[model samples]
Target: MYTIGQVAKFLGVSRDTLKFYEEKELVKPKQNIENGYRKYNRFDIYDITTVNFYREMDIEIKKIQELRKSKSIEGIKSLVDEKEQEVLKEIEYKKLILKKLQIVKEDCEKIKQFLGKYTVKEMKPLEIRGEIEHYTAYEEYETLKENTDSLKKAVTLTSLRRVIRFNDEGMLEDKFIIVRKVEDFEKDIEGEIVSHPKCMYTVIEDGRWSTGGKNTDHNVEASLRKAAIENGYKLLGLVYINLLLTTYEDGLERVFLEMYVPIK
Candidate 1:
């Protein structure tokens, strides 16, 4: 038999912790009626050791109490298995978070390099998976503008939006595509997949004017068209416009837009 303080010292726990275990009914030490002192036997030491071990494993006190009452190996194994699954899920979620952080870091670097610059580059063919809207004549701009909000909402629900231009037998169309580079050929997506052919494209970056009265997209497209024509390259498709960044100041909206036009 050992005194409460001796047992606590042997177990590397405080006497109050042992008292808490007793209060929780997880351990019952013998009482010396003459001195009104608690005494722990070998069985009591074993039970205290078990409780300490489970606590180190992060098991709930209630679960440890139930474990002690049942003394079921299968029950303990089940609890450990459930905890393992939860840990695995957390690991996967954290990995996804890290991946997203890396992607955002790269995007920030790219924007820093390309802001307010005009350049031409050869891009590989890209497959965009998302919803699209088709328009034949310029008169449909109002309807297109009206639907832009809902279209943006839908595309942004699951993925970042990259609006791409398409040419279908000389007809102009706009396709909202996922912004991320996806390597997998097969994907579960909400809309039709359109392919942007591998070609040389001129990219121009501009911003909405401080007056909030500029059509940045139209201006950028015209600039790209002029550059392509001057360089003896024919426009082969509709223009692609991507919103890079937006800021508001002094009650005015400023938006940075990138325009891409395929040439050659």
Candidate 2:
């Protein structure tokens, strides 16, 4: 027989942990009647070791208790199978997080390379769904919620500013929209899918979404008109501004937007 202190030191655990195991009735240590000291036998040590092994496998205390009383080999196998499935699910979730992290790193690089630069490039056609804005309709909100379940999926949704042209009044109007990228296999999408082709591309620093003064100073239609005349290219349809990155500078929020004005 050994003292609780001796067992704790040998097993590399705390005194409170041993006491907790005793309280859970996982181990019954002999108590000295005179000094009221807990005495642990070799059998108690073995039980502690077994309990520790189950815990390292992330088995809950209640489950460990049930396992201690479980005598059937099939019961033990079933528990191990359940734990294996849980670990597999956790691994897949971690993989999704890793992919999102890599995308964020690439976005940061884009900001460094393309901030405030103007050029014409071919924009990829996208099939997207979702609406995240203050005035989003109830139907759109329900559909967005029904489509995605994870934060990674929700944030991966492409954000855009739809600029409607008012050529008569020499003005431009814009609204922000957030939408999810619809995979090619998805056939149940309820609405029309929008697409963009060749565009006058540029990245600009601005405020969050389409608000604040940056949108006013960096006018989308006017900028595209100027760029078109300068490059001797004629502009076509409505403008699409895709949000790339958002960060803070000197206590003010800043957003990097990728503008796509289609050109003929």
Candidate 3:
């Protein structure tokens, strides 16, 4: 027989916890009438150990009570199976959250690297599945609002890509296309299958636009045109504007955009 204090010490539990277990009828201890003290036998100690084990597994107190009353092996197995399924679902949800966090981290890194640099590089053609809308630069936001549903569905399903056409003077024309990858594309999606051509591209990081600065996009376009001419590379096809990041500060909207102008 062990006193309440001795059992509490041995089991790494408090004396009050043992008293509560006794109150719940989880463990029965004999009372010494002569001294009015609680004395726990080996059986009570074993029962306390069982309760502690289940508690460590995060089993609820009510479920643990039910488990204590049940004696069938099959019943215990069924409970364990249910708990296993719940654990697996939690694991899957955590994995999805981790994936989203990783994507955000990568975007932050890309934004940091592309602050004020312009470069020309070869890029592979991109295949996307999303709705395409034709609108001039002046009507860009209005068109986006009109196609908000399509944009939401596409963004929810995959990554975003912007495709824009330019005129003879290297100015953005009145037509544009927005698309996302087709891997997660739904069959009922009302969008065009567009491919961004593979070629050498004049890449400009439009960090200035993020701070609500004026003419950032125009500056980038002029820079690309100047670079193309200086390097003797012929500008071809539509210019694709990829949004790297967008944030709000001091009641103003900031945008980090990248322009990919295909060149030869």
TM for candidate 1 is 0.58
TM-score of each: 0.58, 0.79, 0.58
Q: After superposition, how far is residue 224 of candidate 3 from its true place, in Å?
A: 4.1
Q: Any residue pairs clashing in model 1, and if so which?
A: none
- Give a tens-digit lDDT track for model 1, residues 1-264: 999989988789999999999999999998978998998999999999999998887788988988987857788899888778877877877786687578556656656776655566544334443333433334534433433323323323223334545443433554554333434564644344434443334333333345357545455556555666677766776555555555566656665544556666
* Model 3 / residue 161 / CA error / Å: 4.5
Q: List the pairs of residues colliding in candidate 3.
A: 210-255
Candidate 3 wrong stretches, greater than 4 Å: 14-39, 120-216, 227-264
RMSD of 1: 8.1
lDDT of 2 by residue, 91-169 (tens): 9999978876897898788778777667777766454444444334444555555555455445233443444554535
Cα deviation at 214, candidate 2, in Å, is: 6.3
Q: How many residue pairs clash in each candidate at the backbone level?
A: 0, 0, 1
